[model samples]
Target chain A: MTERIVVSPGDLLGDGVFETLHLRPSGPWLLEEHLARLVRSSSILEMPEPPVDRIRSAISDLSVSSGALRVIYTRSGVLNVSVSTIPATVLRERREGVRVLTADLGFTVRKPPPWSLSAAKSLSYASNFAARRWAARQGADDVVWLSTEGYVLEAPTASVVWLDGGVLCTVPPEEAGILPGITAEHLLSLAGPAGLGAAQRMITGAELSRAGAIWLTSSLRGLAEVVELDGVARDRSPWTPRLLDLLGF
Target chain B: MTERIVVSPGDLLGDGVFETLHLRPSGPWLLEEHLARLVRSSSILEMPEPPVDRIRSAISDLSVSSGALRVIYTRSGVLNVSVSTIPATVLRERREGVRVLTADLGFTVRKPPPWSLSAAKSLSYASNFAARRWAARQGADDVVWLSTEGYVLEAPTASVVWLDGGVLCTVPPEEAGILPGITAEHLLSLAGPAGLGAAQRMITGAELSRAGAIWLTSSLRGLAEVVELDGVARDRSPWTPRLLDLLGF
Candidate 1:
């Protein structure tokens, strides 16, 4: 059942932080990392510390074995918890990979505003959704945002992860001033165990196209391989299955 | 009584557009302009056309004589109409003017992305609120965002307006890619009747500080003069009360 939440109109102004986690039969995957990121996001918004104990208790009471679990905390200290079925698109993209369009985001990675919350998982996500919608209109499944200098930054709702030889690389969150994707970080940590090296580096859009493999990493989608970039079809990579299996997708 | 709204988790994601209008004893101020902007905002987000007649009907059903009336429309076709008391700070600022800090918004006026919603009143307002919070922390009441090239843009929640020589001037919404301020435009339309010239011009932050007078124009606040900018005090402009009276505030 779709859950409904009661909120003040002020809450609708997008002054809040949120976390979406993949709920497994055992429990929420990477609950600790997600919670830690939630705290960091709140700090970036200058919000008061969230009530961690209350949040844990709320999660513990959930009866759903698997789905998407969302926790939202508004600037006015209002908290909401809800569970929803995963969208069919998420599953399809994970299985068949995604066609991504590369577009200039018109942002400079080096010069975010002093009060920039670009690194925060703030509720103000209209731009992100708009970018994906634009991709869909262009006959692509998703979009990868590039900085003004042509550096591949990240995806609309995910982090850009690429494989170069035996090295697994993703953009450095702090340097790029983007939300540190929990799923991407976790996947990179497993690279060494999978006989690969992990690295964080910035690459131009043209250079990114030459990588061994490209994937957009997020919580629910796990890793959606970039099967086609900017209308250019790419050969399937062997690492796709291995990386997905290592992440237990 | 404070009103509560029931919304889905998707509604809190900030993928929506909204309008806030001043409710007076007679009726909502600039109702048509506000509704027009709402439609423009929805278009920018690529949402289906909003049910305008329904919104008008809902506003007519409002019982309160004076307050802040808000209409929110999410990308998922959810529409919410609510009324609430304006914050005391808005009144205080309107009465005594505002102390504003100038900061670079890290945006280039000329390079907005294809899917940019900067001109729309989207629900992605966390950055706007964050900028205001940063100003308050710095002992100011508001902030004026400057483009990366140092040209004056707009305030977090208002449009920048000023008196240059004998002309009333504002930033061109189309050229600057900022939200079209209904209040500012209406005020400028009255400039001729008030025996003043009106214009849309671009100026640098330094030039803005040297204007004869500066103000932030919005619905509820009407006009909040910038009495102090970047910790530099300026004498109160005699035009403040005259403009306020002209606007019926």
Candidate 2:
């Protein structure tokens, strides 16, 4: 589906929040979760409460059956919903996994500024994109950010999840003060059904290296296994396909 | 004059740079400096060099005089120039001074990540504006950010400038990894003509408190004297107006 939008200068200031969902034949995947995150993001930006009913109506009006759905809401009260085909790279990463690098993000987990937007997926995502580009320069498909103290944080655009001692775990959002990963949390909830344990805990880079399997989870990519990390190749995990199936990817 | 335009989804990602200039009867004040800074900002964001000739032509086409001139350029090669009346609060701040609060920005000066955009004046200004709103909630007009080590950094939207022993100084942009302040540099250049010395140095918050005068300098506000800092009232210095006149504000 093709779409166009008229925007004011203020809307371009990045003082906004947005949600990207994996549109399916049935509907956008986990849409309510994405919308809830959007509201949380807006609140962090100190923006007015988004009109959720209006957003739902807008999504229902879209003619495209499956692709990517984007909802953008600016502080200027502009709301835009559009549909487009998901990038081939996203699908490729899901099928083939991704090469990942680890780098110190230069931020301390314990001392965010009072107005820190770390917990919000604000539209100020230049650094997020920049980190990916820097990874590309290093010949990696993506990056997993580490806090200055060597603790594993989230990826640039995804949440870091791993299997350790038969237990599935992801970083705790509140303690890390990061954007809560909806997809990772959902996947963790499914671990019990898959005959595994689920938990949320902090891990250092060294501890992460010892995990049985590592993956980055997001809405569009679903779960991209870190097939290669820090130049070391990893054997394909048997759980990768099963987890993808469980998530309906 | 009012204007509207169409933007792509990528345009709202805050992956661009902008310059806010003071439009004057004789054209934009310090236009060259502002343009140079724009180039530097774009470079930091890995965007291609902005078309300087196009920017100059666009500025020449504006009919409005003596207001705020905003130039926005996205990574998608979209360039926009618009004019709007300066906010009355800006002029008032220049005249009446501002109550300031000092807060730890929770950023260490030495460890910015490889892809950090801290030095760029990118469109991702949501955090900057959020900090100001936070200051407002704290019963202050503005805030001066301090580094994690308690060194004085710039304000949310301006540079920190202070006077000591008849010498006027501001933090060095490169050393502080901040957006260089065009107005403050110009003011410093004119300090010799105003019978004062100029320098760039790093100082702690305590040292800044003991300075004869302190100010936050930006394009629109010119020089907002810090009349009260962290509940401690400061005496007005004679240099405020003389430097303002020298800068032709």
Candidate 3:
């Protein structure tokens, strides 16, 4: 059933922060990290601190075995938590990988505006959705945004991760001025235990094309491998399953 | 009492478009242009055409003499019309002039991304709200954004207009890739009758400081003269009252 909430007009203006989690039979995956990021995003938007205790209580009361859970907090002090079944498309992307296109985002990482919300997971996701639609129109499943200077930034909804030699690398969040991807950070943190080196470095799009493998990481999708980059088909990497297992996805 | 609507969680994501108009005793100001722009904005976002006839009916049914009327349509096909008292600050800014600041938006007009919604008034207004808050923090009343190339762009909630001797000027919407301001365009259309010429041209931030007069134009505010720019106080322009009367405010 679709969940609904009563909201004032101001609440619909997208002046809010949200977190989507992969709710598993065990619990909402990375609950603490996602909540932490939610608070951080609110701070960035200058919203009042979120009601974490009430949010914890709400999450604990849910009986669903597994699904996608979303926590939203608006500037008008509206808080809502809803859970829905994971989309078939998301699951397909996880299993079969995604055909990706690289496009210039028309933003420079060198100097974002003082009030830039690029680093926050704000509710204003129309552009993100539009970019994906543009990719689909070009016969690709998703897009990786490139800065005007030709540096790889990230996918609209995911962090760009690539394997360079024995290292598992994602873009440095602070340096790139992007939302810190919890899944990518967790994977990189576990790289040593899995016998791999982890690093966060800025990579050019051209250099990224030559990486051993690439993946787009997020909370629910975990990691969707880049099956094809700018129309060139890539050989399936054996590390795909190993990395998925390492993350216990 | 605050009005409310029951909406699905998706409705709050800012994947929508909206228009605000001055609801006057004479009826909603510039109703036709706003509705047309609403449709154009919907097209830009790739959303379905809005239910125009229904919207017309909604407006016709409103009996409140005056206020701010907002029409909002989401990607999920939800349409809402609401009216509320104009804020005291808006009236104050209209009667008095505003202290303005110029900030680099860090976006180049040379090449906006293919999926750019900068020209559309999307509900993803968190960034716009943030910019205003940033301006307020800097001891300014409002902001006029400049492209990375130093070309003056629009303000967060209004369009920038200026007078160069006898010609009234504003940034061309198409060339600047910004939203077309109904109030500014209407004012420019009537400029000749008011014994002033009008033009749409690109002006740099530096050049703007020397203009005879400047104002931020919008539906509700009509025009707020720029009494100050970047910490320097500007003398009150005699044209301020004349322009306000010309707009029938």
For every candidate, give the share of true A-B contacts it also has. Answer: 0.83, 0.71, 0.89
* Greater-DockQ candidate between 1 and 2: 1
The C-alpha lDDT values of all candidates are: 0.91, 0.90, 0.94
Ranking by DockQ: 3, 1, 2
Residue-level lDDT of model 3, residues A1-249, one tens digit each, is 989899998888999999999999989999999999999999999999999999999999987868999999999999999899999989999899999999899888988999999999999999999999999999999999998888899899899999999999999989988999999999999999889899999999999999999999998889999999999999888888898888777
Window of ten residues with lowest summed lDDT in model 2 chain A? A1-10
In model 1, which regions exceed 4 Å deviation?
none
Residue A150 lDDT (model 2): 85
Please provide, for model 2 over A15-105, each residue's C-alpha lDDT reduced to its tens digit, 9 standing for 90 to 100.
Answer: 9999889999989999999999999999999999889999999999987888888899988888898888889999999999999999988
State interface RMSD in Å for all models. Answer: 1.1, 1.3, 0.6
> Whose lDDT is higher: candidate 2's or candidate 3's?
3
| Prediction RMSDs, each to the true structure | 1.4, 1.2, 0.8
- How much is the lDDT of residue B24 in candidate 2? 89
Best by DockQ: 3
Per-candidate DockQ vs. reference:
0.80, 0.75, 0.90
Residue pairs of candidate 2 with colliding backbone atoms: none
For each predicted model, how many residue pairs clash, with residues at least 3 apart or on different chains?
A: 0, 0, 0
